[model samples]
Target chain A: MISILKNWVRGSNKLERFWLLSKIEYKLRYYENKLGLVWALIKPLSEIFIYYIAFEVIMKAGIPHFVSYLFIALVLWNFFVESSLGTIQILATKKYLYEYTNMNKIEIYLSVIGSNLIGLFFNILMFFVYYIFIEKGMYVSWHIIFLIPIVLNLVILSLGFSLILSNLYIIAKDIQQIWLIIIGLGFWISPILYKLDTFRAALPGLEYINPISNIIINARNVVLYNHVPEWGLLFWGLIYSVFFLLIGLYLLNRLGSKAAEKL
Target chain B: MELNKEKVAVIARNISKTFYISEDSYNTVKKRLFNLFNTPKPKEVAALKMMNFQIDRGECFGLIGRNGSGKSTLARVLAGVYPTDTGYVKINGSTMLMNLGVGMSHELTARENIYVSGSVLGLKIKEIDKVFDKIVDFAELREFIDTKIKFFSSGMIARLGFSIAVNAGAEIMFLDEILTVGDIKFQEKAIKVFEKSWIDGKTVILVSHSMDVIKKYCQRVAYLKNGVLEYLGDAETAVNMYIAENK
Candidate 1:
């Protein structure tokens, strides 16, 4: 485990690989499209517009400051959904890469995560532009910096899930369908669409157990309320991320070689 | 670290790997329905059974075997891509090259794939950077360096992949019929690179169907039959044994 961790960190210069892969990922997505990177902005903006109409206007939820709340949640939710779904199929999707080359399995995991992050970063940049300029000078607070930790935790968690699911998918082909169901179920349970305060009265126990709930709630707290993350919940989220990461690495180390054979 | 001046670089002692071959693919509904009643049974296939051999440092070893002979299984085991069911592998240095260009993405450019692929072979970015230009020149894809590899022909991709693997600078290397791709000119260039790497004291293990390639490059060779090491000795002897048995 020590050797594996050592190799993961110092053994591979991740920064260089990350930069190269991120660029490649971006280029690949926009390779033939004339719109190219403009889609990055257009995509989220369109999503926000649709959601705003359906949830805020039509549903007529009487919550205070609902537009800003929905926009912020959308930003966070987009990162989570994109990263998780993207990461899940990364290994299986790139099976040809493993079959034809001598590249490390872990790097594939990193590349997907890195690629998603580039998109996530651009989304965040756009989010700020909309929030500060378009939304008419929403008060900027230092707590927005909390996005760093949130992004880091999301990356680790997404990678952990990707590694496990991808490896499992190799062994069990039906996992892709199972994963889709789980994600669909997870979105409702998660606080992405709803505020935790609304749920806290009915299901107080869920706040402790559901890691994503905590992440979403904390992100909202920092961004909307200018409050720090709850230390206990933060600790739990870290534990969840770390535990999944270790499990993912263990599976990768054990079965990564057989991936080519099985694929 | 001065390269180990010894003759033997890799020694596999009674290495074996067993794989569980499932009888059939089960859809989610079927698997769930079946799980409610009983667990599904998978047939066990012994992919490799107690295979053993030794390759000297700087020696180019050849493994010639027909499909389902466990040639790829052994290569994966040696590359630490799979753990052995039994026995072990002792290596003096890193086995850098295995299945070349495995895990590369077409969405990535030739330059980007090099780093991702190189790191998998344990090559640092600086080291890859040093040989980056040389690799591009060798692949002869300088014009399309920045273009996404998806745009390149399969042969061009193979050429770029081969260049990176050969130049990744591992003391030990494994090639599994990866040369079968690319044109004759590229194959010739690849052979020259293989020869140069071998002369520079890099241990090479090559699996190929071409008898001429085996005889010309490898000093020692092994033949695997039914997941067992059937023959091991001089390349010429093994080739002859393989030919006689197959015929």
Candidate 2:
């Protein structure tokens, strides 16, 4: 238990190091693009538009309030997908940095997440502006405050996934190729585009098992429906986040040092 | 935290690293199916074998070896960058500068890289800030402090890297061929900094091919021959032995 506490403290300190590196990442990514950070909102907004047309207009899912639901879900899901996939290549791409510094491997993992969070936060903030003020039709409520905890939970999930993927990619190069396929399959399995109620009756226990489904649904409820998230589901998602994070961190702590040797 | 001045700062015992040289394990599916009926091929390489050493606090030690002689493997093991398969490393206070400018991103400005690189070396931002001017002055890139490091010359990059490293204030420092950077003037400047660090009771383990560097700075030297510790004694004798053997 004491060791766990020590590890927690060490992990928190490593997060600060990640915060520092994320500044570099932000600078490097936007250096060539003249539009600068406006590109963050532009990219996600474009993705939302494409998915909205495909699912709501063309496929004719006939789901109620499809536009608002799609908007909220895509914004939240974008954070998780971008963070996890970006983290897949974190250790592999930063091989020179890890080989040279005394920095913790966990820091490299978290830095990618941190940089993604910056863009994710911008995207989320824009959703509010577009829904509340610009559209001038949707209602805004205090329940939107639920986004804070939900975003935190998403971060925990991404960090956990990053821990496993980064370390595993070192041992098996094929993991990257396999990860893309898994992520694509994961999108279908989760309720990113579809409603949980649509699948809950057919799949029963399976929909609840996917924590991302609960997170996306909760985010949509707060942003679109102006309703508080279901406490039971929220609690389960938090538990899963913690569980995955602990397991991932354990594997990372055990295997991270071997990365340099393997590479 | 006060340190024991006379105690051993780093200890390595029976350290070894083995790596597999995989050859075409992912043959086409049809070919893989056919290979099941044929003899399986074997491919592997052991990078390091049973290396061991210890360094007293404030000692300036040198590591000399030919290319692919496992000097880097030993350095990585000491830095905790690579986990040892068989042994353990007990380090008191170590910071590895394994490769200069490896951590700095090209897009970040000089000021930003200082904080990022400094933290990676285990220095707090406040500590780095205190020495910020000195770091810049040493690098001699004050005119372009706000410019992105990518725009800087290779020499300037090396200067920035070395300056940040020197100011990190680790009790034990490991440098791998960092002196090969910049011009002769800058090299002389770096040598002065190294000498000053030694005088201030810092333990420095320098891994370089420059016989002159090893002979000039190190009080004692160790020769790594094919992942084995060949000799660890006087600096002059070790350099002579290395030169003789390679010739």
Candidate 3:
């Protein structure tokens, strides 16, 4: 374990391979589309606008730039959902490369999460630009710095979760179906569409247990509310990320070369 | 028939692998949840059973077996595709699985797939650029290099795949039934390359059902039966035993 960790830090080959694969994967996602990555933004923007029409214009749940506010959190939520579902199929899909070459199987999962992150990063940039510059004077503050940790933590959590899901998915494909239901339920339970402040008051325990709630709430705090994410919660989130990562590594090691069996 | 520098190339010791076939192949979450009430267990089949063998450096070896006799499984295990159940497989030098379409992407053009598969075979893009023309020339697909592989005939794709795998410069090459493909002319050229360098040096393990090809090319051969090493010795004897058993 020490040696493996040491090699990861010392060697750059794995990182290089990760970059090559993710670059291809990211490019391939929009390869066939004539409009290219505009489609990536268009799909989410359309969904957010529908919600905006219902909540802000129609229902008068108007709380500041509520549309962009809602968009920011929903965008982050989509990243997790997309990354989770996408990562589940990475190993099974790329079985040929990892099976044939000396390439590490974990590279498949890493490259997938890495590739999805580029899209999520762009979405965040677009939303923040519209929120701060175009929409104007929403009390932008130093708390915006927390957005860095927010994205980093999301990637870490996703990688950890993905490592576990992709490995289990090899043997028991039922996990994918179960994951779909969990992801569907995840959106409702998390504070993506609703206010975190309300959830904090109404069901504080849910906020603590559900990491997704923390991520969405943390994103909203930096991007919209202009407030610092709770440091204690953020610390817990880091620990949560580490725990998942360790568990993911454990499960992957347990599966071993047996992963290619079902494939 | 032995070279002076007869170093050990591959030492495979007591390797074994078992695959579990789920009773319900399509066990979705709904069915699995239901199966919790009245469950059926996955059935395990040992694909390779405690097998030991070695191939010398600069040797051309053939693995022959009946279908499902673990010939391909052994190659895959040695190639590090599937992990063995319990054993050691130590192979010197870079290894590549020469099964046609080992990493061919149908959506990508033949040129693009060359890069994709070349990279998968551990070649940097720059390295592929240096040998790109040679690979294209060898496959004789220069005109259709940029055409998507899906549009190409099966033989064309196989030829392209074979060309890339061969030129990838793997010191230990594992050719799994790819030699049997392509035209007579191409096979003749491939056989020449085999006789010239494949015999001169660079260990090659060929897994094929063609006894004639095995007898013609292999210096020594190993015969597998139901995951067991049934025979390992002179090529002619192994081939005769294999042919007789199948008969």
Q: State every prediction's TM-score relative to the real structure.
A: 0.84, 0.85, 0.88
Give per-residue CA lDDT, model 3, range A10-76, as digits (tens): 4434455567778778887865779998998897889888988887788887577777778888788
Report how far off residue A158 is in candidate 2 (Å).
Answer: 1.1
For residue B143, what is the lDDT in candidate 2? 91
Model 2, residue A47: what's the lDDT? Answer: 77
**lDDT of predicted model 2:** 0.77
lDDT of 2 at B19: 71
TM-score of chain A of each: 0.87, 0.87, 0.90
Kindly list the per-residue Cα lDDT of model 2 for residues A135-167, writing each as its tens digit. Answer: 645788899899899989989998898887777
- Clashing residue pair totals per candidate (backbone < 3 A): 16, 0, 0
Each prediction's DockQ? 0.41, 0.43, 0.44
lDDT of 2 by residue, B1-247 (tens): 3435468878888888887665665423344567677735646557788877788887888989898888877777777777788888777754665466556767678998888777776666667889999999998988999998889988888888888777764567788888776899998988788778654678888899999989888888999787778898999889988999887
**Worst window of 10 by summed lDDT in candidate 1 chain A:** A95-104
Error at A7, model 3, angstroms: 10
- The TM-score between candidate 2 and the true structure equals 0.85
